[model samples]
Target: MNKSMNVFVIIALVMLSGCFPSNDLEKKQVHLTGITMGTVAYNIKYIEQPIDGGTPIPSDVVVHQNVERILKQLNQDMSNWIPDSELSKFNSHDSLSPVKISEGLRRVIAESIRLGHLSEGKLDVTIGPLINLWGFGPEARPEKAPTQEEIAQAQARTGIDNLMLEGNMLTKRIPNLYVDLSTIAKGYAVDLVAEYLDSISAHNYLVEIGGELRAKGFKHTGELWSVAIEKPVSTERAVHQIIIPKDNAIATSGDYRKYFEENGQRYSHIIDPDTGKPINHKLVSVTVIHPSSMTADGLSTAMMLMGPEKAYAFAEEHKIAAYLISKSENGFIEQFTVEFMPYLK
Candidate 1:
């Protein structure tokens, strides 16, 4: 399948699992859903009440418009597919000279670089060339696996050391060093939307972009916001677990929904930067909970690349609240960090 088409399917599957409330919910909460960042959908659920019993909360229409505007601006700055987006322009630049970037993009790129180090270079933004070669990027899927020579060439152009961010300016250590922020951009968008909601006094709300989510405060009924973790099976959509995540962000990365199988071999879109190939392991999905959705997003991808055992150990060492699901002959095996147990339902 085309990468874009697969993304739409993934978004649809994400939407199917707790992206909206059930029909029996109270009417006091405002729910809004819309498309953003190509194939992802943004869902916002917030409680509506008067301020000081005198000023009315912003109308749903106004809130939606504001959210859309914020997301549009974010896309313009970070989307690599936009051709003229800031990231796109930077990628196409062949100079080692510093290029000034928007504060938002700068923050995201800096965080991505920091995560690349934290994950032992597992989550590299400079892996774009390899990703495109593996048929999981903007380029069309190839008819066969890339040749060793092709893979070597792509790998040569990729490295976390090839990029640097100083203040609001980003510079490349090597020419034609491409950087793709797809792994972390949606999560940043989620955080950005959540920040905007807070600015408007939408304290009690849930913000989700793509599959990354953040929730704060309580619902209209005085309960914490609930979210469902989808089972890792591709054949069916089932809730693996539900959690009332209060004042924290959640992100999940999985290979089940985004991969191509050929001759009984599966190639996932989640590439391991060090290998320049999709991760081949029993680990199927990783869900991370943190205060920053961006951090959780990057960590989930890094954990997936680390596979099951190493990822579990890494989570334990870092004291991160992470949930891991792995493929087994008996079906699936689920595990969680000590810190994550309290949120499981």
Candidate 2:
């Protein structure tokens, strides 16, 4: 599957975004950058001063290797591109039987099911079949759009209810039920790296995988790190907002960049499970902030399924820090929940 099509958010990091004065940052900061999770680029940064005060710190080489190791293990367990990945194996399993999976796999699947259920089927990870039918997954773009019969057949294989988890054992109630965790996998990886850094007493750091990100503590400038949220536009990248993390992780979902058009009708890469087609609503973007990048990732995608009005009410009712943008006759309309006020620049 093309993992890049899973999300449309573009978050520009402050430290690297030229937000801070170049001559100001003189403190020792260890910045690590690499590509992982099948084309996702990430960079982790932390002040060496924090390690200086800790009991002992691993060498930079060890830290890099371990971080990449964690990412590699995660990919082996959950990535859809890896043919032998645990997730791919399970998807190929055409039996209604229980299969033992790794604890890490169980963790991500459990959260995905929970959020899928909570959102009332708005974010089903089991929508892989429909995704492929729409030519968004590993399959090539169909010569033409799928017929209703084809869509119904694929939709039958979806639904979070078809999946069940008993401890570390995950089961598929239907023989053809396929699961895909592309939506939330990067966020889980982000949290995993952050936890590992925390275990090493690296509190003052920022971790990002793809667009899902998390941060803690102040930067070398003795101030909290800020991140830029780009406006939802296909022409050019523009900063829509710059906000502090509030000691939380951030995830954004949008549909401007990934879509297909046919005969004047536009189809987004973000599928609506209810209809088994691309979302056609006016809500173009959704960004959420929470302590857990995984949760924020799930919520952002879930809110994208809900149009602007419903998403706004949902965020307010849940007291979630959400920023939503919708298309209008004049221009894009922006709305943020009260909880999101503190995050504004």
Off-target runs (Cα >4 Å) in candidate 2 are: 1-11, 15-26
Instruction: Give one digit per residue, the lDDT tens place, for model 2 in 25-127.
Output: 5556789999997678998987665444565557668889999999999999998788999999999989887999999999999999999888888989999
In Å, residue 124's CA in model 1 sits off its true spot by 0.7
Q: After superposition, how far is residue 296 of candidate 1 from its true place, in Å?
A: 0.6
Residue-wise lDDT of candidate 1 within 1-345, one digit each (tens)? 001101111212221123223343343889999999888877888877633444567899999999899999999998877999989999998999999999999989999999999889998989999889988888999989888798889999989988998899899999999999999998999999899888777777888888899998766655567777787878876777676666899999999999898788889999887777889999998999999999999999999999998999999999999988888776777888988987766
The C-alpha TM-scores of every prediction are 0.91, 0.92
Clashing pairs in 1: none
How badly does each model clash, as a count of residue pairs?
Answer: 0, 0
Evaluate residue 315 in candidate 2 and report its C-alpha lDDT on the 0 to 100 scale.
87
Measured by TM-score, the strongest candidate is 2
Off by over 4 Å in 1: 1-27, 50-56
